[model samples]
Target: MDAHTVTRIGSHDKDLQELFCDYVPQVFRRADFRRWRAWGQWSDDYHAYALMEAGRVVANTSVMRMRLVLEGREVTGYQLGAVGCLPSHRGRGLARVAMNAALDACGDAPVLLFANPTVRQFYPRFGFQPQRQTLFTTTYDSVPEGPPALTLNLDDEEVRAGLVALSSEGLPSTERFGARGYATVASWPVANGFARPLRQLGSEAWVFAGVEGETLYLDDVFAREPFDLRAWIPRLIDRPIRAIRFGFTPERYWPGAVEAGEDTEADLFVRNLQLSPEAHRFPIMAHT
Candidate 1:
């Protein structure tokens, strides 16, 4: 016989908050929780449902509110984050309990998550189908005129808003608009000075990236002007940059050296179709 209680804890629950904060570094094992704690930013809108056993959190899953747009219509959904169970708590189905509780709390909104390839098969049983993203690659030499560049400093609110402003430049094509009201922004910072600022051509280029190896992978891009991304490739590098990659591609197509392919490098699994899968992409900047 097992006895445990399930509770949804937000920032207000001080004691459980401390316990969960301690538990994350243990289960995740790879991320720097210290940086996350140092940020000192907590979202009351994000909730973690945990299985409490003997006064300790054993299994947990976080649920986040998402205000999405599908074909220009407003839609609501939720994103699942940091789902795991303590090593000793495995095989106990505590994760399942926490997940179900999250879904119920979310009512009927769709639930989405980015899952690793190894555990990709686990979400389907819970009704999480794979969502596809379009990828673009190109190697170009033409240096075309483009919107001036602007450095995206996470420390600066204006810069962050400029990044968010790109979502509304013309029409809502991706999921950044859905994340407008949510403070769940999380991303790998621009490092090594491969690049400093996210370039913009009058709100055209919504991007953040640093080069690695010889390839300049734009952490993400959403430039709808003229549509051909190859024209903007040359502007991305100050010294020398080789091939370019898109973290997320727009539904519209662009000509030139750019090549397109449907890929699964980053997998999004959704339990509900609250947001249509057609030409859908959650921007890299909106990661939680």
Candidate 2:
């Protein structure tokens, strides 16, 4: 094996893109790579660092600036994402190298991230601890009963606006909206492998379902009221769907709507980031 020298570079740098093009394919499919690209646009607001050995990328990490409105004031913070390390370079501490570079650039703003189950234990070395658990709710038997009708369409522009609106309503403290939110919703139609005419329930409610294999994934549902889970539950159950998966809706927001089940906690995990006293912060909105 050849000895490798690791170098950290910024994502905005031209060489980083070349290295990303080279290394992304080695780890993700074309579609996944594109999704990451979309996220990069928003995630890039803070800064990105990549670990390179000779001319090839071995690891990568990014930090995005965020503002949260907490307790009636705004707080600035950082959200971390786009973390990866090539398999061949896993054991060489390249991930640590990339993260340290990002932290140095971040200069002590509170940082946050939602980690995969596999890597939950890996982030604590950098002063991260479990803060909160994200919950997912699905209902099969008790769908919405005569809820207000909504016309739901998956237009890129509408989806973008919907997300921005949701962010404003939910995360009023944040000063910037990153591309990850837009890209995730924009790529939903194709990535989840389903295409259907926009579904309209009424004037104020709309639902879009993403079907993969045998499961129907409710990618996004829009409604006028934040507490109107009843309206959208029927939209999902109306279909001949075997199962449904919704992401990042905590119990506090929905109250008694989310019935506890085995997969009820499917999205449950501890967030390891905290907000600094100086930065304005608000409740984290789960939008993926």
Candidate maximizing lDDT: 1
Query: What's the lDDT for candidate 2?
Result: 0.48
lDDT for 31 in candidate 2 is 22
Candidate 2 residue lDDT tens string, 2-101? 2233444444565566666577657544423344344343244435577766777777776666553333355566666657788887887878888777
Prediction RMSDs, each to the true structure:
4.6, 6.9
- What pairs collide in candidate 1? 67-178, 147-201, 151-197
**What is the overall TM-score of model 1 with all chains considered together?**
0.75
Question: Could you tell me how far off, in angstroms, the CA of residue 41 lies in candidate 2 after the best superposition?
Answer: 4.1
Per-candidate TM equals: 0.75, 0.61
Model 1 over residues 1-288: C-alpha lDDT tens digits?
A: 143567888866778777787788678765433344334444566788988877787888888776665555666788887788999879877888888888888887877787778888777878788877656667744332445355556455565455545544533334322344433344323321223356664456555654655666665554444455455565665546656665544444323325366656667787766545444456555555
Q: Which candidate is the best by TM-score?
A: 1
Go through the candidates in order and give each one's C-alpha lDDT. Answer: 0.61, 0.48
* Candidate 2 C-alpha error for residue 37, in Å: 3.2
